[model samples]
Target chain A: MSRRFASLGLALALVCGLAPARESAAADTYAVDAVHSAVVFRIKHMNTSHSWGRFNELTGTFALDEASPSQSHFEFQVKTGSVDTGNAKRDQHIKGPDFFNATQFPTISFKSTSVAKGADGYDVTGELTLHGVTKPITVKIVPVGVGKGPTGGSIAGIDTSFTLKRSDFGMNKMVGPVGDDVWVNVSIEGGKK
Target chain B: MSPAGMMLATLVLPFVSAGLVMIGAGWLGRRLGIERADHAAAALAVGVGYVVGHAAIASPTFPPLDVTDRIPWLAGLAAILGILESIWPGPSWTLWENRLLLTALVLSALLGPLFAESSENRPSTVCLVVYGLIALASWTNLSGLADRLSGARLGVPLLTVGFGIAIALVVSGSLALGQLSAVLAAAVAAMVLLKLGSPMLLGTVPVMVATFGALLLNSFIYAALPASAAVALVSAPAAFWVSRLGRMERLATWKVVLVTEFATLIPVGIALALAFSASPGYAE
Candidate 1:
């Protein structure tokens, strides 16, 4: 009877010790607030003016630990096939191999590597993969206004931007007239993962 | 001076240099018994086609008024290729020659319809120039094959890999037309240096031509825009002289030229894109 009681106590203690990890994981859940979040980009159309584009369906999760923010991580997956450039014909062309090669590479994604606090915001370094090519990029994420949702959910807002070279991953089809530097603007709204 | 003079300086000189080189290549090919001078001449002609295509429809002012010029540079390149074939028996180079003709034809077919779509003209013609230049690079590769001349001395595999890297940049929107060309020129020039045992004098020209050519072209496009007029004016001389120094330097100048131009243009591309995207009136 004593042995059974002691075993039960040990199991309970182990569970208690691991409780923090489980709870932290649960606390890290994040829901992208669609109304407040966006993924945007700008590229040179000719050498003249910038062409702008955005992806509408941005679905992601953010896992964070308040005590150890370095343990925080994010997973963002955007539908490459969902690119919007305000023109249907051009969108089709862009989705082709010359640009996104969406059929061949359907998802645009980012997985967080490290995060550091800065004066104005935080620098988030991650591996961003687009069109089957992946590269390491650092995005300076400026904390936009953060607040509570009407539903009493904790919401954190972040605005970040990064510059990437398209050729690093293999999308070197368009040049001469079209500017190459693809600038990405990300507005993220996260809740506990 | 006439508006033409400014345009000629900004847009015409590269073509002239390209043409002069074609003439020299033809003479040299014959002198050195280097097989096919015609192919080199044809390549030069395509270079002229690129300049003329870019310069054709502008106001000849400091900033030529538009962003997208669709002046049929491909047609000129095609015509020259056609002429070259007739002058020289090209069956020896069928594989590459055919691919060149086919690609030009395809581009023309794809873009040809747009010519008649509207005469309203895009404010900046950078996109079209980019497409044309990519085609030019394709042509260069094709011509290189036809003449049995490996211009960069990099094996076909490395060249393919470099092109693949470039394509990734294009798709990801990290390196646009200008940056792509600059990088490619740099890569090609570096290859020449490496292959030639880093010969200081002979190796410098291609690097100068490729790097400065890209920067000058980009700066000229920027200058042609009235909105970017100030920035272009300040940077144009810098582009010109940097290129001039690249040209005049006898050392293996590829590293300096390529790195400087690339570093300078990359940030410019990011800033220009962000600035334009942030503007209110522009359509996103």
Candidate 2:
């Protein structure tokens, strides 16, 4: 009976010790709230107007280090196959070899190499891989808003917009009517640990 | 690029290059005294035509990044294999041995791109096994594809299948793959047109099989080609055996050609019909 009590005490101590470490890790790195995030883009269509589309699936995490801001980093991965351009037929075409070839190169990912706080937002320089091509690109991430959840965790809202040429990523198809330049907007909400 | 430019690159250029090389092959063979020039000619024609079209379409990215990019290189390799298969005066068993080894290479070349980099994008192991088997069937001579050709028995069928697959891929949603299919088809067409007179020592069977296998598998796996349509297209290679029947052998040359093309067309027709019928849902 005494030995059983001792084992219980040790197990409780181990659980209590692991909790803080787990929470600290969680506090530093926040998993992206995919439901609250949007990756939308628009390209010039028929040399007339902008045609918009978005990816429906996203995942990744971001680390925040307030004491050492330079230590902060972001990693985002978007499923190229989840593109939703409203029209299913066009989406199928875009997903094929003419453009994304999503089956072979499924994810377009970004991992920040450097991050610096700017006047408007955070200037993040990272390697953005799209369509099996990787390139270093910079984007300014501005704080959109913040809120407190019912569970008392803080929520962060981030908004960023950038323009990229599809040709840069080796997506050299339908250039004129589809436009070389594609404007992208990312709005994301993350829960702090 | 403009429609005219795409047409010129994917269609006209391939036709012109293939025609020039084939016409030149006969003259060059006589001068060089290379007995197997027909095989080399056929392989070179497809290789040159595909590379030219690929360069125009994808713009020659060195160390090819995607499966589509790797096809041009595969075409070159398949051409070499075709020439070697024709010229190498090895025993029948030795031919089978070489083909067994080549089958693995061909399988890896086609399926490697899909399985190389990403885990999430991978097909199930069962699917991989099935595709590998399908590839083996298409790549090897087990289906009675002769190592050396005496006639255009294979070419006529191949031409029908090639055009069928091209149109099928186009209707299925991927114009890029369709155009690439057309590039291969045009090259095959030129070879068949030039070699019509003498079926003597034609060497393009292996490369034709390799290319059609690649295009059929690639379009179905990556593009919007449906399973039913793919099944019909896969039947194309075996359809040529119909021409080798006892009845077909006794017919006149022109009658044999007509009969061979018709036999091949059944599968091609089903494939095309399937693609067209399903287009409203996919290409709308």
Candidate 3:
């Protein structure tokens, strides 16, 4: 009975000793709040006007290490079929092969390769896979702030904007009339997970 | 320019180039020291050049490698095969060599689309087997037709035109596909002019490669039209066999052309109707 008590005490001590170490190594993880977050893009239309479109479905997670920002990681996926440009006909057309070929590719995704501190916020370099093509892209992520949510959960807000040429992702169908460069803006609200 | 204007220009560029090449085929053929300038080769080169140039101009930065891009690469492979066939001539090729080449070209064209489709849902092995069989059968049928009508001055050109028109109609649902269809039409139009007088056999290899490549792109990559519709359009050339009917035995050349066109139009019309019906309002 004494030996059993001593073993139990040693196990308890070991657990207590590892808790702080684990806490120190753990980075805060946030689950993207889809209801609040949005991925939107704008492209030139007929070289005359800018047409705005947005993806309805977005899911991602990010690990933030405030002490060492470079250790932060980010991942995101946008459903190509969920593209909405207001007009249903146009949305369907974009979902077709002429633009997205969503059936074949399904989704456009990004996975961060590296993160670095920047003057404004953070420069996150990642591989963006779109239209079945994967290319390394960097986006400037500006942290909005971290605060307590109405639900008493920790919430973090981030804003990122980047310009990507559609042709870079093999969407080289209409060029002159519809401009090639596409401006993407991401506003994300993440809850602590 | 407007989108329509851009599309028209893209479509016309290949036709103009083909016409120029056709007009100069004799001189080019003589200059190259070949029996003929090889109209099919010219078509392949011009078609591929236009596609590449269009891609380059549209997006100076080429897209990263992907399965859909294989269509252009396969077209390039077909062009290389066409050049070799022109230089070496098909009669000298061994039976096994022909078979191997045919298999390679067909497989390359089919695999890319198959892989693309497989990603949508898990395609069973049975489906793949059926697909492979269909591809082989289509390749055999089209290649045989091309071989039989090779030396016929008007037959191949008429069939090519029918194919181009059919593909254009089928792909009209999608602007990108329509552009590709236009490129194909321009290539064949050029081939028709180039091979007008000399009439060297346009080898079956390029036809199989380009036709199958385009069909795969239409069915798998873009899926703008139903697969059955694309099949009907591509296989419409088999209607060339209609010329072998008893009524066509003693018919005049113009009558033959008219009859063949009529027969080919049946399938082409059906394909067009199906494609347009599939897309309620695909107007760009």
Per-candidate DockQ values are: 0.02, 0.39, 0.37
Q: Please rank every candidate by lDDT, starting with the best.
A: 2, 3, 1
| Model 3: per-residue Cα lDDT over A2-55, one tens digit each | 999999999999999999987878778888998899999999987789999999
lDDT of each: 0.49, 0.77, 0.66
For B184-278, candidate 2 gives per-residue lDDT tens digits of 88887787777766563335655666666777777777788888999888877687777668777777767776787888888889889998777
The candidate that wins on DockQ is: 2
Clashing residue pairs in candidate 2, if any? none
Clashes of each: 49, 0, 0
Model 2: CAPRI class: acceptable
Per-residue C-alpha lDDT of model 1 across residues B189-221, encoded as one tens digit per residue: 333333333222211222222322332333233
- Full candidate order by DockQ, most accurate first: 2, 3, 1
* DockQ comparison, 1 vs 2, better candidate: 2
TM-score of chain B of each: 0.28, 0.86, 0.74
Candidate 2 per-residue lDDT, tens place, A1-193, comes to 9999999999999999999976665426667898989999999988889889999999987865545557778899999999999888889888887788888789999999988888887888999999888999999988677777677888877888999998888887667757999999998888875
Name the better of 1 and 3 by DockQ.
Answer: 3
Model 1, total clashes: 49
